[model samples]
Target: MSKSGNPTLIIASFFSIYVIWGSTYLLNKIAVTELPPFMLASIRFTTAGVLIFILAKFLGINLAISRKQFLNTVIAGFLFLTFGNGVVVWALRYVDSGFAALEISAQPLIVLLLMRILQGKKIKLMSMIGVILGIIGVYLLVSQKAIINQENSIAGMIMIFMCMLSWAYGSLFVSKADLPSNYFVNTGYQMVTGGILLLLTSFIFGETWTSPMVWSTPVQYTMILLIVFGSIVAFTSFNYLLKVVSPEKVATSTYVNPIIALTLGWYFLNENITVQSMIAAVVLLTGVYFINTKKKLLIFSRFSGRLSKKLK
Candidate 1:
């Protein structure tokens, strides 16, 4: 893709990552209602991974990688997709999709903190303010009576937080890891490895597996969308945008995704959106914006460019 791509294509790619990626929370919520979380995620990703390989072959993209790169991809797949994504799907059973999206919006904050603790990176003044507001926003979001009152919600929230840590560390790891040069090839390896791990998890947990034929129509449709759009199309668009536009411009999805997820969950699942949630969303997104402000010493943006690749 050229750096100066067609304007219409640029707009469409942005739409894919912003809207389509956001809707995945709702899609997972709907699917998890009928299928076991790991199983659902396994099926979706394994199929998508194979499809990606086929597409890469057709496009004449090389699929070979060193053993070291393969191992790194395995680790990354486990961190980013197997645990980061699959566990969130499990959490969906207890938490509302919108609520989950809102909570996950604090990821940049977590990444910043991890960088400080792990790498001894100094946080900029603006990023420090973002951290403070992010904390308040998170407290406001999770402390809601309506949300906490739900059974298992606390566990779900805690697990989701752990997943954020996994993703944050994964982001840091990916920045330095020697992986496939082609984005498509890298993602294909990660999805395939991650999907295999999820399959193993499902078996270990004794989650019942059933044929798609028996799935409800809505669930079948959701699976199709998740596999085709959520995993494949949105990811492809993300890579395209990263090549054609500035990372800062592509990073706007960080702010837009949660809002889209919240709206869709409210409209389709009738998930309640309290006034506090709205307030928290604004504050949280503002914090993210502040943290993402361009700076010479900003490590967040450097890792974030890698982070956004796997964040759907």
Candidate 2:
């Protein structure tokens, strides 16, 4: 195995993704108050893309991927960033941050099912159980304090659900697509392409601002933090994990991000946590563990059996 595949690097990647990504929801919430959600998302990604692209060049990385690979990356980028994250930013204007989170948390379960339907992958029984548990967990999580209050705009809820679906499809496509061999170059293209799409959509929808940037103190800090940690560090780590781990395992971050969002929301915004929140977090984590572990173990056992026969 390459040095990058060592357990320490893998564990670091996991933590980087969990902590940074989990924190983004709250940062996004803060940014939305001062910036039009679409505009903010566009700027955030644009900045990140430019920075990454510059860095890749300085490091002497050749990003001259094939035309077919470029097209696939563009499609993946549009699905993931433009539709997935862009919709969330827009939805936040109408929905509570926590409620928006609960909806997005459904992504892993949705991805699991989509892989079965679209990729024709066999759904292991344990992972299927995880999916079932996750559904129940989501019900409990959202039902708590009516996580999504009916008073919350129905349009907002639908948009966030669409975000989840977009991310799911994008992730599935990433697994199948012939992407760039280098992680940094591919991510750079994705960020740039996706951010441009986001900006174009925002313009088409007439989302604009008359004032030069003005943000509340907390929002300003949040924006900086998101640009530095969320877009750069977290996204890079996510791409790294996708390279080292199985996609399904990397996808487990979806199950974990909500918990991080819940904690940060309660800490920073004084959002209330409920009994149901605890229950749902437990169910969802349990489900994720079951789904990933069983499949991993099965593969390990098969490898071990083959090795034993050869040794004998």
Candidate 3:
């Protein structure tokens, strides 16, 4: 348990990320069936961003940001949301939501390797083992004949992997970039900017747009849930957890989210959860655990602790 904050709040925060974020895959899958992907993401983030600013005002948090910080937020927004999330939503049209979630679960592995390549950081022996296992797991997951045989499945998988790279690079950039001191304010800026960019992308791609009133009932409900819970509430909890708990502990969401996604996809969407995917998920999550596990690296602990505090 974390040494700070109420235990109940901490538990609730964990639940938000573990379950709410996990369920987003299913919700998005449902929505994208009826709505255009980029347009859907644009509306969700824009609405959520506006709502966040309203909440911040109610809380009396400062929203002023420097130009440099604004630029950083835009860059982060593009990498994390515009490209990273928007493309994934688009790809969901071609791939199962569970499979997409499972593939994204390898993000930790991507981040670890990115740190090594970009920052010249040394990978510990345990992390090296994790890298090997992650590669094998990914191979197992993507190599299955059933998945590859599906139309556009290969394209979807490839694009999702590219989005992971974008997200991984964005993670590295944010660790050093200057941004709003308040996490809520910072996230609001990112959401707004990212959403705007997504809207532009939608226009460029000639995606059809429709009013919320005309949307199907399920899509309407999904959009509301996505904006309220997935983007705002869950993200707030994620930032809160980073402040109160060790990141490795917060990262337990990585393990639980895909399980929730897989089960929900199977139950609600009738998406297949093949035996190979299950095996890959286990191996991949195990590798993520190994990569996140620490052994008294005082320097990293101090750095991450400071980063977490500053991020809030």
Candidate 4:
């Protein structure tokens, strides 16, 4: 970690991700209390995107993108933000934020599966075990809670599951696609594209910004927090980490964020946490750890070789 970058900056960036990104879930719940999910998210992302773009321009960053590149950014944005983020916010209406975060924490497992299916990569034995454990963890997490907030927890889990899939594909696509060199600028374009898509989607769903006049003080603050800390600060930190540290190290945030979100939900919203939920969190995060770690122990390498020989 020390060799990766300035040790202080790395610690600060990790802290930003661990706490700020984690808190976004709770903030989303607060915002959705009064604002419709699509409209709220559109506002959040658009404002942040525009601001970031302007800042990038002021910093003399190249903002030029070709038509094809722009379209890729748009498609990636729809996958990453419109579908990925919008659904999570919408599901918050039906689900506890903690549960939703846990579902998202299983994304590494989903990404591994997608890599195998879409790209023909072989799934290693340890990674296969990680995927199975992730599935079981999610099953245990959602089994006990059938309904929440008068909506189906099963449906919420399904939506969040889709969110993970969208993010997984979006990330994979972005990695292969032609994107801007500057991470901040690329992210800004994606955000703006997603915000526009969400705005159109809001109209399609007949979602009106009818509650602006009646929006609570807390809701307003929640929106500000999301735009400032959640979108700007935390996202910048994440991008910074990607540039300076190994992605595997940064991936640990998936596990930490859920723990922080669960604690906050229980502390602030008085959300009930069962023994099963705790155990499931442990299982899910452990699965994520396995998927993220690139190092192979001798046992797994030998076992994989033996299995391949037998199969051949």
Best by TM-score: 3
For each predicted model, how many residue pairs clash, with residues at least 3 apart or on different chains? 0, 0, 0, 0
Report the CA-based lDDT of candidate 1 relative to the real structure: 0.87
TM-score of each: 0.87, 0.86, 0.88, 0.87
Worst 10 residues of 1 by lDDT: 242-251
Instruction: Candidate 3: give its CA RMSD in angstroms.
Output: 7.6
- Model 2: per-residue Cα lDDT over 1-312, one tens digit each: 221466887888888777788889888988887788778888888788889888888999987899998898789778878888988888877766665675666677877788889879888767888889888887776565454554655678778878888887877677657888787778888888888998898899998753435667787777778877888778777777776776777777866687788888888888777777777778877777767686665876799899999999
Residue-level lDDT for 9 in candidate 3: 84
Shift of residue 126 alpha carbon in model 3, Å: 1.3
lDDT of 2 at 109: 80
CA displacement after TM-score superposition, residue 73 of candidate 2 (Å): 1.8
Candidate 1 lDDT for residue 114? 80
Q: Compared to the true structure, candidate 1 yields what TM-score?
A: 0.87
Query: What is the TM-score of candidate 3?
Result: 0.88
Name the TM-score of candidate 4. Answer: 0.87
Q: Model 3 off-target regions past 4 Å?
A: 1-12, 239-252, 295-312
